[model samples]
Target: AQTVTQSQPEMSVQEAETVTLSCTYDTSESDYYLFWYKQPPSRQMILVIRQEAYKQQNATENRFSVNFQKAAKSFSLKISDSQLGDAAMYFCAYRNINNAGNMLTFGGGTRLMVKP
Candidate 1:
């Protein structure tokens, strides 16, 4: 079974500063998808970024990017120039490459607190 792990249970960042969240996973499949999701106080799950295992280049969206290490099965998210709105619970999710219609298996989640 594939599993996702987030070493940090909670994290804090000053407004306008950057922070990186650590995540690692164990998967037997060579091709799969890794994702970072953000859940705010509202509890809505939002996709922060996604990286395909087959892609060598990392994925970036706005102020978010990932360091995907397929060999090590490590996928981390970096939040650059963070803002107050960035405060949320960040989760690492895994999806099978072959199962397109299946839902994602998520990590416990890392709660991000933004201080002004």
Candidate 2:
């Protein structure tokens, strides 16, 4: 069984600064994908970034990046140049690469508060 964990229940970042959200997971499978999704007050899950377990290089998208520690089973999300729009509930998710259903296991979620 795979499980995602977000220890931080809430986080606050100043506009133009950077913030990193902590996440860890326990999984027996070696092949899987890690993802960070953001849900605003609208409640829509938006993909922020993803990292494949086999990839040595971390995945990056714009101001979003991930620190993937495969051996430690840790995947953390870093948001650079944070903006007010970045305020949302951030969730860490996992999915088995070989699974056709592609079911996602998500963490409890961290609510981000951006300050001007």
Candidate 3:
């Protein structure tokens, strides 16, 4: 079983600036995947980035990046050059590598507000 936590229910960032959203997770499995997902007003979930538990390097996608700390069980997302399109509900999730259904355990999402 896995449990993820997003301490900040909401976070605000200025346009063109940078913002970091915090996430912590608990998992008994040694091999798993950690991810950051973005859901806009349309409710479509988009994969922001992914980190493998065995990998030490952080995951980065374009303007999005993650600070993944395996020991601390932390996976925080850092949005660089924030834009209006980046405003959305961000979720931290995870799943065992061998999951059959690929079902993901998600954290209580954090709403990101981009201020112009």
Candidate 4:
């Protein structure tokens, strides 16, 4: 069985600053994909970034990036130049590449509060 863990239930950051949210997972499969999804007040799950287990370089999208430590099964999300619009519930998800159904195993989300 695979499981994702987010130790911090909630976090806050000042506008324009950087914030890092921690995520760890346990999995026996070698081929899998990790993701960070942001769900704002609108309740839409937005894909923030993704990292493949075979990739050595961390995945980045604009001000959003991931520090993927495969050896430790740690995938953390870094949000730079934080803005008020960035405030949302961020979820860490996992999916095995071999699964045909493509089910996602999500972690207990971390709520990010951006303060002005």
Candidate 5:
């Protein structure tokens, strides 16, 4: 069985600062996938980023980046230049690489509150 864990239950960042959310997983499968999804107050689920197990390089988006430590089964998300809009519930998710439809297993989540 695979499980995702977010150690931080909540985090805060200044309007223009940066924040890192920690996540770790336990999976016996060598090939798998990791993802970070954001759920805003509106309850809309959005994909933040994803990392493939076969890739060595960390995945990055505009202001979002991941520190993927395959050996440790760790995948942390770093948000740069955090804005008020970045405040949301961030969930760490994992999926089996060979599974069809790729259902994601998610962590409890980390609530990010941005201060202006």
Candidate 6:
């Protein structure tokens, strides 16, 4: 079984500042994919970043980056130079490579609020 946890239910960051959202996961499988998704008020699930279990380097996309500690099973998302557009509900998800259905197991989610 695999599980993702976002200890913080809500987070707030000042505009132009940096914020890091915590995410911890437990999985028995060695090969899997970890993802950070953002859903705004419009309800569109957007992929913020992704990391492969076998990859040693952390994944980064523009202002978003992940601190992927495979040994510790921690995949925290760091948003640098936060902007108003970054405010959204963020979810940490896991997908096992062996699962044919391609279903994703998601965390409770953390709602991010940006302050001007």
**Global lDDT of each candidate:** 0.92, 0.95, 0.94, 0.97, 0.95, 0.96
The better candidate by lDDT, 1 or 2, is: 2
**Tens digits of lDDT, candidate 2, 1-116:** 78899999999999999999999999889889999999999999999999999999999999999999999999999999999999999999999988799899999999999999
Could you give candidate 3's per-residue lDDT for residues 1-116 as a string of tens digits?
67999999999999999999999999778889999999999999999999999999998999999999888999999999999999999999998899999999999999999999
Model 4 TM-score, all chains together: 0.99
Give the per-residue lDDT digits (tens) of candidate 1, residues 1-116.
Answer: 88899999999999888899999998889999999999999998888899999999999998999999889999999998888999999999999998768788888899999899
Each model's TM-score? 0.96, 0.97, 0.97, 0.99, 0.97, 0.98
What is the per-residue lDDT of model 6 for residues 1-116, given as tens digits with 9 covering 90 to 100?
A: 88999999999999999999999999988989999999999999999899999999999999999999988999999999999999999999999989899999999999999999
Best by lDDT: 4
Q: Predicted candidate 2: what Cα RMSD to the true structure?
A: 0.7
Regions of model 3 farther than 4 Å from truth: none
Clashes per candidate, residues 3 or more apart or on different chains: 0, 0, 0, 0, 0, 0
**lDDT ranking, best first:** 4, 6, 5, 2, 3, 1
**lDDT computed for candidate 4:** 0.97
Q: By the lDDT metric, which is better: model 2 or model 3?
A: 2
**Which candidate comes out best when scored by TM-score?**
4
Clashes of 3: 0
- Model 1 lDDT-worst window of ten: 98-107
Candidate 4 C-alpha RMSD relative to the actual structure: 0.5
Better of 3 and 6 by TM-score: 6
All candidates: CA RMSD (Å): 0.9, 0.7, 0.8, 0.5, 0.7, 0.6
Candidate 6 runs further than 4 Å off: none
**In model 4, which runs have C-alpha deviations exceeding 4 angstroms?**
none
Higher-ranked by TM-score: 4 or 6: 4
lDDT of 5 by residue, 69-90 (tens): 9999999999999999999999
